[model samples]
Target: MKSNDKLAIHELLNKAAYGYDSRNVDMLVDCFAEGAVMSMSITDGDLIGPFEGQNEIMKLMTGAMEGQMDTRLHNISNIFFEKEADEAATVLSSLTLTAVENGSIRLLTTGIYRDEVVKVGGSWKISKRHLDLELPF
Candidate 1:
């Protein structure tokens, strides 16, 4: 891989992690494409749905994170990127999330993110992302 490609991948991953941790809905939306998909498992059930556009993605994230007095730290590891073309790639990464709530910091979740990314306007954006989480039952 060329140095520039490595840099692009790193930037993309960092942006994603930062966006989520900061709870910046707009930033998160910018990381994905129009009609992008994001799904994850929750205690209630699987929150599986497609976010058709950036506006919808913003609404989903804002509503989901609302009223949670929690600050999250995203530790992204084992990122493997497969080049699908000059403008696209498939990436897989493991994530460990730590959160602080009620003055206690703890490991909140662990998950894997399978993502399809495309370069849009010279920046990598996620076209699809599936999050599979592991929880103790």
Candidate 2:
């Protein structure tokens, strides 16, 4: 991959984390493609979803946001490309989730995010994502 493409992918991943951290609906919405899908597995348990389509994915995200009482920080790290091409890539990264409540902070979970991203209209957008969490957050 070109250096610029790598950087853009990194930025795209970080943007998604920042969107969730700040609860910015528009930012979150912008990170996904129209037909994006998301799924998760917690503690090696059964698959929680393959929430197909951007709307379903957003519904899952918004519902989680509503249920939270603390400020969340989703730290993305160890990003690497497993495969890449001009229009699409498979990426992997680590997630460290923390929550702050009542002036105290604690680790909620750590996870591995496997994402498939594609260039759409000159920007990288997540087309599919599957998160494997070490614990329920």
Candidate 3:
């Protein structure tokens, strides 16, 4: 991969992590393509499904955050990227989430996010993302 291509992919993935960690849904959605697909499984509460399109993805992600009254943090690590072309790439990132809920702070979840990224209209966006949940709660 070219240096610029690598850097661009890194930036895209970093933005995605930061956006999600901060619960910034708008920015999070900005990382995705219009017809992107996202799937997330939750071990607690009511979050488990495959959401298609940017709108649905936003609703589900933002909705999950709405239930939290305390702060939460999603830490992403082990990011790996491979460029398919100047306009496309694949990214894999592992995440560990911790949140304070009902007066207790505990690990809320852990998972791997496998994402397909594409440059559309000169902007990087996620074409698809599959979240593999690993934590029991």
Q: Each candidate's root-mean-square deviation in Å? A: 2.7, 0.6, 3.3
Best-to-worst order by lDDT is: 2, 3, 1
Worst 10 residues of 2 by lDDT: 20-29
Which stretches of model 1 miss by more than 4 angstroms? 42-47
Top candidate (lDDT)? 2
Tens-digit per-residue lDDT, 1-137, candidate 3: 56676677778777877886688887898888899988766553455667889899888778877877777777877878744677788888888878876788888779888889888887778898887777654
Sort order, TM-score high to low? 2, 1, 3
Provide the lowest-lDDT 10-residue window in model 1.
42-51
Q: What does the lDDT read for residue 63 in candidate 1?
A: 80
Provide the global lDDT of candidate 3 against the true structure.
Answer: 0.79
Judged by lDDT relative to the true structure, which candidate is superior, 1 or 3?
3
List the pairs of residues colliding in candidate 2: none
Question: What's model 3's TM-score?
Answer: 0.81
Candidate 1, 27-60: lDDT as tens digits: 7777878777776665446676766666766777
Q: Local distance difference test, per candidate?
A: 0.76, 0.96, 0.79
Query: What RMSD value applies to candidate 3?
Result: 3.3
Model 1's alpha-carbon lDDT is 0.76
Candidate 2 residue-pair clash tally: 0
- Comparing 1 and 3 by TM-score, which wins? 1
